[model samples]
Target chain A: MDKRREVAVLSELDKKLINLLQHGLPVCERPFAQVAEQVDSTEDEVIAHLVDLKERKVLSRFGPMFDAVYLGGAFTLAALAVPEEDFAKVTEQVNSFEQIAHNYRRTHYYNMWFVIGTESVEEIEQVVQGIEEKTGLEVLNVPKLKEFFVGLYLPV
Target chain B: MSENNNIALTSLEREYIIATQKGLPLVAKPYHAVAEQLNISVEQVLSMTKDLQERGIIRRVAAVPNHYKLGYQYNGMTVWDISDEHAEKFGQMVGNLPFVSHCYLRPRFLPKWNYNLFAMVHGKTPEEMHQLRSQIKELLKDVLVERNDDSSQNIPTQSNDMLTSTEILKKTGLRLKDKTA
Candidate 1:
């Protein structure tokens, strides 16, 4: 079961802060202060809210979102179709690799989907080959040929 | 942007990423905390962060709220078998939709996989997701490949489909291995 289905109740101020902060916070001596000003709250209050949100697992991360490729690394969205009997073992093998950043079970013929983030472009291929050998399954290596849009802004 | 060159993180920048990749300290002066930890001045941290952003390395310094916690429980990876000729044109149209969070063009694995355009859509419920999917379908109606029901070709029978994640097996922030270690 999806454990995150339980929704967290948000106050009006929390929603306002989240909507504003998702776009970004300024880079300065007091970034939270700037956010507080825009959200019509005190710096301490803003920080408190953020701390609460993080503790509650509402905000997964609060920091700079780095581009893997730009940082001399490579990442690709790959998928695999594992036999039901071997699903558990294959998952352990795939997740054991530190390069596998995220793995999910989706409803499809190609059930297991994971993202491989490596230190270099060449390393992406190496990891893919490793996964294929480990699981004995064809890994669909699909790196983005072109990105039309990439942004996550969900208004609470 | 296709050409992967002219972008390399400096040693200090790498250290900065390693230090803060998980997250910044939840403090009034988060940068100050980072600067103190790295044994650098606040000005240096600020400047380095700004430089990274300017170089397109750091997409943004922001808060990433979990959509599930925000009432967006239904999320789908909506993929389409778009014609290569009109993929770019139709991709842009679908991406421009306010509900679409991410849209991209990816290579198709001929016999096994046929989706070329991928768009991620999130909604509070299944009905909402279906509606949003319909909107995208209507926008790409002209370019979407007709359903290939031919079983002989070994291709996907549908023109488009949505993959709803059933379980999150593993999830973690991208970690950059430390070379000095």
Candidate 2:
């Protein structure tokens, strides 16, 4: 953890920017412009800061938060226990899909866990099967049996 | 809104949501910033965001935790060997608890493992965490607490990615030391 990157050391303006990005992108045609206006800066400045933020790695990828159910996209959370030797190859294959958003190699029996957001349940299952068949690993379909309130709130 | 409604998302929408999950725009018109990036009107952003929230597509958009910094010193990932018949009942009941932040069911790795229900709890210290666990125990005494067999290791990779990292997990506390790993 870069002490410098610690959110506390940031300037109020930057803090506000972090807070803004934390909640979401401003909903406006000229969002940066709108944010610029709010922070009393130019739209260009807001965009620049975001780019810098990404460079710093504080902000991961910047874009959209999809609602799979709404847009009719079928998505699922799946995992596979890839042998340590095969981890790299399996990951390369899994990440190959545009549907794989976030993948994590965690410590569990079923290790290389990933999320796939696609267009339909059948399609999602088919993709899962393909990954398993190709990787020669069991892909566990741990779909959310029940939707629970998943809120990541860290009081700033 | 029948909270169960799953509205599939557009590629553009998915991109924006992933980006913003870190945190929403703090600007007075945060939605406007999003609209600008998407090359759409602020009004459209606001309307869609509202729809997402209403549809439970995007859960509450808010600030995430720096657990260690916040003094939530202990975290525990508790699993239950719940029978399939009552798994949903147990999961939903446990999920609704204020302290029980996250609850979910995963396919059990049988022969070797059979715990199906998993939950994550966070507290200021080991004692606090233990106390919370006891409370959970009293509530779930009927359900058998699965023996934790996995060695400690995992987190921060996910913790490092705050927004999209909000899934209910199974590690907490001194385990947080392993978090940075």
Candidate 3:
């Protein structure tokens, strides 16, 4: 986790670009130019700052935020409480599946938490069953009953 | 819309998703770059993307910054067991908080697990994370349940807890398998 941390000191321009672009970029031929106009900067300068941010690992992604569920897919948050000795092996078995989109090691009794993304809603159950069989662990499959909000706007 | 809704993706749409899933090119004409790759007209690419967004497929065309790199080093997946009757009301209130990035009401597995409300919060330090957690607790104080003292009960002893991530085992964003391969 420490190795992945590259704390970049963001400049005023970088912060402005991030805070503005996060809401969304216009879906036009020259969106950057529009953003530049809003920020009182040039299109090339905005592009250069964004490129630098991406390279510095500050920007994880810069594109369309697709909704997997809307795209005829399903996603569920699942957890497994693997034994200490089998942690490494269990992580490998669980992650081998392409369906596992994001996996995290959390501080909890049921430590190994991951999100399963499948092409269809019904396949979510199948993936859960597969992971349980492969790891010999009980999976706590928790799908969202109601989504209150999901807009991620972190002001830098 | 039902979660089971099967909105079939056209072959071109699938190709477009595959082409731009990594990210759009940083150029004067980003859509044109994707159009060139798929051998489709620039107008077609732009129109398809707009259609997808209008259909609620694409949430937004945006830049997602790494929170940790931006000094938000501490992130806690705060879970709570709130009254089902007032869950929706309280969920909305908690979700409206600026610091709360994601808030959802999920099912609980009784006996072992009991948290039905999950809200992810981030902070620059552990102290800040705790403060945010406290703010959430204060917001849902009325709806939050107090665990029964009876040892024989099949419910968890605690009503809420924050599970901070220790490591990112895998961080690959969603990927669609190339069926043609």
Per model, kept true contacts as a fraction are: 0.79, 0.17, 0.75
Poorest stretch of ten by lDDT in candidate 1 chain B: B1-10
Model 1 pairs in collision: none
Which is better, 1 or 3, measured by DockQ?
Answer: 1
**Looking at candidate 1, what TM-score does chain B attain?**
0.88
- Give me the displacement of residue A38 in model 2, in angstroms: 16
Residue B109 accuracy (lDDT) in model 1: 77
Give the alpha-carbon lDDT of every model: 0.87, 0.57, 0.86
TM-score of chain B of each: 0.88, 0.70, 0.88
Of 1 and 3, the candidate ranking higher by TM-score = 1
The residue ranges of model 1 lying beyond 4 angstroms of the native Cα positions read: A1-3, B1-6, B153-155
Off by over 4 Å in 3: B1-4, B38-41, B149-156
| Model 3 residue A126 lDDT score | 88
Q: Each predicted complex: what DockQ?
A: 0.69, 0.14, 0.68
The C-alpha local distance difference test score for the whole of candidate 3 amounts to 0.86
- TM-score of candidate 3 relative to the true fold: 0.91
Report the error of model 3 at residue A62, Å: 1.0
